[model samples]
Target: MKRKLRSGITASLLAVTACMALHSPQSLAARDAQTILKETCQGCHTPEADNALSRISHQRKTPEGWLMSIARMQTMHGLQISDDDRRTLVKYLADTQGLAPSETDGVRYALERRLNTVEKFDDQTSQMCGRCHSGARVALQRRPAQEWERLVNFHLGQWPSLEYQALSRDRDWFDLARKEMVPLLAKRYPLDNPAWKKWQASAPKAQAFVGDWNFSGHLPGKGELAGVMSVTADGDDTFKVSVKGQYADGSPFNGDGSAILYTGYEWRGNVTIDGVTMRQVFAAQGSAMQGRMFEAEHDERGLDFVAAKQGSSRLLAVQPGYLKAGTETEVTLIGSGLSGKPNFGKGVEVLEVVEQSPDRIKLKLKAAANAQPGLRSVMVGSLKGPTLSVYSTIAEVKVVPAFSVARIGDGGGSTPKVQGRFDAEAWGKGADGKLYRIGVFPAQWKVEPFDDRAREDEDVKFAGTMQADSGVFTPGDAGPNPERKMSTNNAGNLKVIAAVDDSGKSLTGEGQMIVTVQRWNNPPIP
Candidate 1:
């Protein structure tokens, strides 16, 4: 079955309000994690022997997981809590009872809204739970066997259709869930892991991000970018962030937004640049931070952002980071503490230094026509970091995402249309006989029918429009189309194709896109 990346939550999920002073300074300060927990949760959650509350005490989760829990409380348990109090509870629970950084390493895709990720899991877990939601969703939490069993019960009790689903109907779903899944989940992700204990005892304070930072990223439609971000403390775990930089084309990239640090390292920021609102989901560790930042509304359009604090002298990236083996071009090295002589490895010659700075170094360079095609390490002074590709010919062009999903909406409705973004990644075989990724290159985009059914149904004409130069696929409007047979909604299977011209040679890559209906169940996690 084709996997649809973008899904939605129902309107019934919890609503978290914007961050602001909803109460007096004294009142807010008085309502710490413990105080709010006692007043809000003590009614339903029984106190344990060690002063821990039931259910919540036995599990560890990310900030989003906790938020979902509170949202569920409001929807299913008649728990009426203010937005301010809910936010406080989420922070407190996440910080004190959250997963360790190591625990969240591989699952950051779910948090970053890289919704296109194809999940892999053991058969029992995948078929039993992940068939409906993400396996990452289950892997994100650490729970005891008892809690896992309780969760299984909750699933069957809440959604009584559990036994009627395709895979579930073939067997004793409840027996397998309790007997097989409970033990598997418990052993795989135990509540008493040592990483959690260590993290809880030594996690850094939220103020760690109060300083200047060097950042670099790439947005699909908008070229490469590098800049500096300044952060300041706003409230308890909240921050005020400002970014100043420019795209590779010298276009200014400036914005300011508020941020909230959850579980010490999770950095969530909302900034607006040139009137476009963007959100940052980064992990801060000491002086370095990295993550993806996307437009809050249209998440498909985003940048893979990486940043280092101002103090580090590490080389971050090379803007316009590629050069044709026989061509001369100007490229900027964006980093910290760039000095001394500059080098671009073997085949590249530094003709002149266009600009130099402590944070940036611009140089005019040329690659020999006989340059061995591969990624060349860039160096500035003694510090060695960052790499740019040198290739004479495009060996192959592969669409970045081999498969994805786009939604049909914005036809006078609450849910907006989800666009399908694509990038053409060029690769070359080096002298050592390894396929090295050159980088994202310009391409002409088009769509065709995926199968004979799609062709017979005229899906290409009715599904959507693919931008030629930008590779942006915007799906058609929602509701039934009178022109299509049966007047069906504008949903169809499409073959996304990209044509690239390297020098004079043409290369093409193809991917799959499912333009489908609206998903009303969008939530913070999914």
Candidate 2:
């Protein structure tokens, strides 16, 4: 049977090429049909064959059938023929390679043989069975024929959208596949298989959790708040905790940061909560534990926090600091300065010691009120000694004065230019310790117009002078001082030269007065 099948396949393949030569103009011109058949088709099909293709050919299919067969080969086997070549090849094959009744058996046998080899049982079986489940999962199941059939039927019916068409169109193929698959599964993945048994026995169990907690705390000027917490089991060792409560004034919490509860309770494994999934590791005492928390929803915003059980209660201590009058200072307070503790009001009493006289000290108390008074303070201090007592008190606040100018503009003169002066009292403290007063006058000057309109007039001339105290001069003697020039123009821009004193030295230093041209204004005001 095998020899006959192989021979039939060989003949059918030869006949295919023989038909191609008879029709193709390119091949027809150089080679006869027999030569094309011998070279291209004999490798796979022969004259003395019993293949599926030969059997179908023997039945005398219509022209359309021959065309379909040729089209299937071109599409499946990368037959690089143009459309016109395909039509020519198909016509020749139908005319010259038509099969007789006596050859029908050989053709049918060849086709069946080819079908068996081409319709892969392993690949199709694996793909179909693995659509909704693992291959190993299906293989591990040892079911009787009826049970297997029922399972296949259930899959086809249950997933009407997935397996219905395959089951209906290729019912025989599926049956044959199942027949081959069942025995292989029964032999290799029997119910008694150790690996299969182990997997079934060792599947992870559901998580579990325990206990409830409550917290009541004060939030400085924000007032009092309380929260309730409860833990529940997820699976074997995993647990989920739910927390809900409100602020002092009774506002409902919402969303993840609000009232939503968390589900991360993976004691021996991991759990996900409030979009924060975590792997949990327990401590020996079972009271303390640590793990990394991943932000499931916002993966980029993940953070880690430690959780511990004290007695029957759980405490979550985040970084602590004070938000006072727009100032955020992180200072730990001891003794009477502790805020939000029992008995203390919502404010702190700050004691300031001022110098009433050289010998006498004056005490001034500044009281800050809030929900929990003693907890927050400007300065938290501690006194170390025999008992090592700790305490915090308000520190004396210093006020630094800032300087401001009162006016600035042109001092009308022969130069008809820009000039202005600043208020001495507003200038504030200088390096001399005492409040210093300073003034500036036009020592030198020049002027430019508001627009390029004045640049057109080359004869227009303007000039003035300006003077300023040494206090207003920048600290360093860096030459390119921008403030030195009162105005600018294309007249190579104005230049200011400080006057020489009686000693024939430049008066550019210390408490000295120097004069230079300042600037000019056109069309002086009345």
Candidate 3:
């Protein structure tokens, strides 16, 4: 059997809430890991005669990893433990058995919840392993060949329908995994590495981040933002963080939050930015940090964030971030200690420095008709700034939130339709054969069914309408609609298309959007 009950329970768990508070403050007093596991988990996670736990003892993971595992046990296997006990057990396992810092470097992106991260794997591994989940999930582990082989067996045994899935149906998945994959994975990720040994011998007693840092990031559709952050230790591994920054438009933005570091490197924070709550997932390594920041409510909207130790002079951000070929555009450079005439990297010409300050510089910058396109470094005197992108003819236009979801508004005197926004950007191929961004541009917006089946079902007409000038979709109200399949809510899978005029040519790009039902109990970490 495929363990349908577990699958349904997991779906419910994930769909409903990302964080579960199952214990009161009084119940969270520290307890021995052995006692808690024996009382709540031993019924299924039976200990061997050696007094060692079965699968739990063999595996090592970050606190978040252990939390997910325990949550699965609670939901699927009927394990029961107070919230305090669960927290205590997770800490015990992570502190004693977590991967070293170096071991976590590759998969930190996964833990940080960064969007659009590409996982690298060889062709064999990609087909054999990544066909189901991320390759980073594989890279995050260390095991012997025998153990890897057994894990493959576990997958097949737990989900007997694996062999019938699209990726495995036509291939000898079981045989190849047993023979080729086991050895490849074992050799690739041996348990003992020299770096880990060195780190363990001299690892600092505490590696809490407690200082001011400078940060810069790009928010898709919102342009570039630069800021300074102050972090102070709030607990052994928790922090209080404050941020002060501005968007490219010079609008002041400020945020305050708290964070908890799990496994020493993973920093997860809940904060409010620009009057809206947001979550931050960043990794700290020595004097540098980088990660993703997104809305606490809707994770689909996120951006890249990076920071370096404070007190250094560097370029932090470039407003608009890109220049259209042969067009004169005003650019703002946000940074610290900026001086002298700025160099606009290659293929860019500065007409005049409009204004100057230690932290802000505005200039009229232009790219020649034949200028090279792509991200180029910015420099002013000894201070280096963020990158600027340039592009010529609009080779393409892509709508962001490529795959989007929106829910209809509740009909109890509320607006009849929920609005979803979209932004379109133009892009051009650079000399290096890579696509260079041309930034957002005004475009004609339209919506259509994602496929022929959706088109025949008239989804675009019943589900929503795309506001041509603004690129926003207003979805129909929620209810059982007899027009839709199964008489469900007015939901749809749609393609948002953007068309822009470049010189005399018209270019178009499309992205996926889905209008669905409302989500209850949306959690910050989901």
Candidate 2 lDDT score relative to the true structure: 0.30
TM-score of each: 0.94, 0.19, 0.77
lDDT of each: 0.83, 0.30, 0.71
Clashing pairs in 3: 315-384, 315-385
Show the lowest summed lDDT stretch of 10 residues, model 3: 18-27
Top-scoring candidate (lDDT): 1
The model with the greatest TM-score is: 1
Root-mean-square deviation (CA) per prediction: 3.7, 36.4, 5.2
Off by over 4 Å in 2: 1-209, 213-228, 245-285, 289-294, 303-320, 323-526
User: Which order, best to worst by TM-score?
Assistant: 1, 3, 2
User: Per-residue lDDT tens digits of candidate 1, residues 1-526?
Assistant: 1222221132223332322211111135346778777888999998898889999899998877887888788766878877767777877787888888899988888878887778878788789888888888888999999999999999999889889998999999999999988999999989899988888788788777788898899988678999999999888777788999888778998998888888888777788877898878888888789999888778788889988788778788887778989899998888777779888889899999989988888899999999988898888889888788998777888986889899999878777899999899998888888888888998999999999999999999988999999999999999888999999989999999999998788899999999999866766677
Clash count for each candidate, listed in order shown: 6, 72, 2
lDDT of 2 by residue, 1-526 (tens): 9976564454344344433332222322344434444554445545555432322223222122354445445534544444445444444453333322222222221211111111222665555664443343343223344445555666656455653454335555456546765556545433233432343344333321254333233321123334443556543332455545454367632122211111121122223443444322221123333332222221112222233332332323211222222122221221211222211123433344332221111233333422221222222122110111111212111111111111122334222111211111111132334332221111212223323543343212322222343112111121233433443321212222222221232232111111123211110000
Candidate closer to the true structure by lDDT (higher is better), 1 or 3: 1
Over the stretch 241-289, how does candidate 3's per-residue lDDT look in tens digits?
8999887678876988877665555567777887887777776666667
Cα TM-score of candidate 2: 0.19
